[model samples]
Target: MPTDDLGGRGERIAAAYLTHQGLRVLDRNWRCRDGEVDIVAREGSALVFCEVKTRRATGFGHPVEAVTPAKQRRLRVLAQRWLAAHDEHAPDLRFDVVGVLVRQSGPAEVTHLRGAFT
Candidate 1:
């Protein structure tokens, strides 16, 4: 699959999984001047900002491993900007990672790591 196709599929899987877990989706592919969030949802009283990483194999590494500290920092900044744009009021928030691994001969798998980092 093309890179974009793979990314879209991963995001779709992540959204579905979150919904199945009882989270209400607020947005998909939310962007601002700062950065973009792959999936946004409300889990009970908290708002979730999710980053999705997809891989065809682990030759490089697990998909979640790609969300480095720098990436986390960026996510934080983006989330802050997102909140600012909505209102000065901040909601309970958390960062999450959704790892989607697809294999040509096997079923795809999704791993959701909530509060993976601050």
Candidate 2:
């Protein structure tokens, strides 16, 4: 599958997993001039901004490793933009990274790294 398609699939899987864990999804692929957040969710009283990274294998590195510090910074900026645009507020906030490993013969494996960055 194409990389973009794989990424979309991973986002879907990540959203489902988060929902199963009791997080209410607020947005998917939320974008702004700064960047995009793969998924936005509400976990109890905290707001969550998630980045989804998918890979066929770990040849290069674990999918989560792809979320560099720069990327995390961008995500934080984007989150602020999202909030400002929507005029929403949360008492607490979190950044999460979801790594999806696709397999040719079986279901994809998903790893959710919550509070990945400040």
Candidate 3:
């Protein structure tokens, strides 16, 4: 599959997993002038911003490892932009990473890294 398609699939899987974990999904692929936030959800009083990274294998590195420091900073900025646009407030905020490994002959593996970054 194409990279974009793979990413979209990963986001769908991640959103489903998060919903099962009790977070209410508010948005997906939210974009601004700064960047895009893959998933936005409400976990009780906390606003959760998630970044989904999908890979066919771990040859280069684990998908979560792709979320570099710079990327984390960008996600934080994007989260603030998302909040401002909605005029929403949360008592707490969190950054999460959902790593998806899609195999050709087996079920995809998903790893949720809650509070992966500040």
lDDT of 1: 0.90
Best by lDDT: 3
Please, what are the lDDT tens digits per residue for candidate 3 over residues 1-118? 9999999888898899999999999999998889899999999999999999999999999999999999999998999899989976899999999999988888889999999999
lDDT of 3 at 11: 87
What ranges in model 2 sit over 4 Å off? none
Clashes of 3: 0
Candidate 3 stretches greater than 4 Å from native: none
Model 2 lDDT tens row, 1-118: 9988988888888899999999999999988878788999999889999999999999999999999999999999999988888855789999999999988879989999999999
Kindly list the per-residue Cα lDDT of model 1 for residues 30-117, writing each as its tens digit: 8988789998888878988999999999999999999999999999999888887775333679999999998787678998999999
Candidates 1 and 2, the one with greater lDDT: 2
Please give the ranking of all candidate structures by lDDT, highest first, separated by commas: 3, 2, 1
- How many residue pairs collide in each prediction? 0, 0, 0
**Residue 118 in candidate 2 has what lDDT?**
100
Runs of candidate 1 exceeding 4 Å displacement: 87-91
Model 2, residue pairs in steric clash: none
